[model samples]
Target: MKITLEKVHGSMNTFYMVDGEERDDYANLALQLCAKDQGVDGLLVILPSNSAHAKMRVFNRDGSEASMCGNGLRCVARYVCEKEGVDEAVIETMKADLAVRREETLMDGIETYSVQISPVSFQLKDLPMEYDNQTTLIQQAIPEISEEIMFSAVAVPNPHLIGIVPEEIQKSPEHQKKWAEKFNGQNNYFSDGVNVSYVTKVGQGIFVRTYERGVGFTNACGTAMTASALISCMSDMVPFGEVAVYNPGGMVKCTVNKSGDTFELLLTGNATRLSVHEFQWEEEQVDSEFTAFEILDEQRQYEKFIEEISVVVEQFAKRKE
Candidate 1:
């Protein structure tokens, strides 16, 4: 079987966007294609939807399916909107039907999209975290993670454990990988697994480093950044408005909103197309050698935008490279 896929990214969190018309073994495909050689974080499958413009299913490199992925949704939003010749779209995710639209211009020559991340919750039952039988964690010390640093748990429909760390911890990447390894493994914290992020405020903006649940340390995690921004607002780390959330990958704009008891957020960032590939698939195996490839030019523009805005974060991101 022949397969055509578009390589894309949001905040440099890359993915392979494929239509769900061909083979059905997405789990295997993600496991194989998201390897180091393929150089993608996950796979995004666009399936037919009756309730919205399209449906998005995310498969991590570890063959785990997430409830929702903010970055992948942005990429999917742009892809479907452009394919259907529309300016806006309502995409059905695992948890909610999200509204996404093209941004007029976020950066020069970059395609930006804004998407709704909703059904936010702070209850422990939602994240299902087990810690001393606590119901909610709000700027409280979690000794398991750090004896001094405090954490706040939030689920943007996908579980996240965020902590506002000090400058010392923020500069040390090894510390994050250490704790991420502990929580992602069989300890006693997140049983099912959770995305862990250590964030710090930097001149009205915040820099976030994430250890994603199934993807391990990543350049960015869309839901994690959204959760981090919301936690920052609730914890008074940053004002409740448009926050410049910087990650190792790039930066994104987040706005937190609340009405009555409900909370939702808007995540805006670049959805740059990287390249196109033609591959052969048979018996759940994706050919490593592509017959033909078309590398796109949007990445240079995206890198330029990142270079201009990410002086502080870029230094840290370079360590990942």
Candidate 2:
């Protein structure tokens, strides 16, 4: 059977969107297609929602499922909007029904989408973290990683551990990779594993690098960035406003708000449509071969956008020095 798919990315965290089909082995399909060297980061299966506009299911590269993915949500929103020829849409995720809107274009041909990342919670049960009687994990010391490495855990329905590292440590790619490896897995402190973000404060923005739970060392993790922004605001490091979150992939803006015990998060970034392809699927195989794959040639436009942002980042880094 021929299946249509779209390769999309938000803040460089890519996923393949496929129409929902009656398949019992979607996990295996996600594993085959989400390989870094072959496919993308994960798969988003579009489903029909009776109460909402559309429904989406998120699957990570390792055949594990996620409750929500902020980056993936943006791409799905764009997909739904374009397909329906609408300016806005509501996407029902596993965690919550999110509202997304088409914002001003980030670049020529590159559209920006903002998604509401909501119902924030810090309760251990929410993150389902085993932290020994702790209701919240905020800058707590975990001797496993380092007594010095303080982390804050939060769940926007997707669990994340945020670390505010020194600028020197953040600058070293090797350090970031090693730390991510140490804290993620069956034998790690987080038994269920968690998305880890190491962040550093820049002038008015923050630089973040993430090691996702199922997908490790991605160019960016949208929820991780939102978690970092929330932690920054909690620590009074950043004002309650749009926090510029710069990842290795590109930059996304997160607006955070706190009112007493309630918190709200909004993520604004590029929801890029990279390519479209049609593939053939067999019932017995784990992987599918594309019968007709076509690149949209938007790579050049995306590259230009990246180059322009790099110049700005370099200037910002230089000023900090």
* Top-TM-score structure, candidate number: 1
Could you tell me which residue pairs clash in candidate 1? none
| C-alpha RMSD by candidate, in order | 1.7, 3.4
Cα lDDT of candidate 2 equals 0.80
1-321: candidate 1 lDDT, tens digit per residue = 678989999988889889875345888877867663456889999999989999999999898989999999999999999999999999999889999999966788999999999878888889878888889888898776678888888889999989888888888878888888887889787888889999999888898999998898888899999999998988888888799998888889999876777777999999989999886655544444456789989999887887787677864555243
Our model 2 lands, by Cα RMSD against the true structure, at 3.4
Task: Give Cα distance to truth, residue 63, candidate 2, Å.
Answer: 1.1
Badly placed stretches (over 4 Å) of model 2 are 35-39, 311-321
How would you encode candidate 2's per-residue C-alpha lDDT over 159-201 as one tens digit per residue? 8888888877776657656766765755424667788888888
lDDT of each: 0.86, 0.80
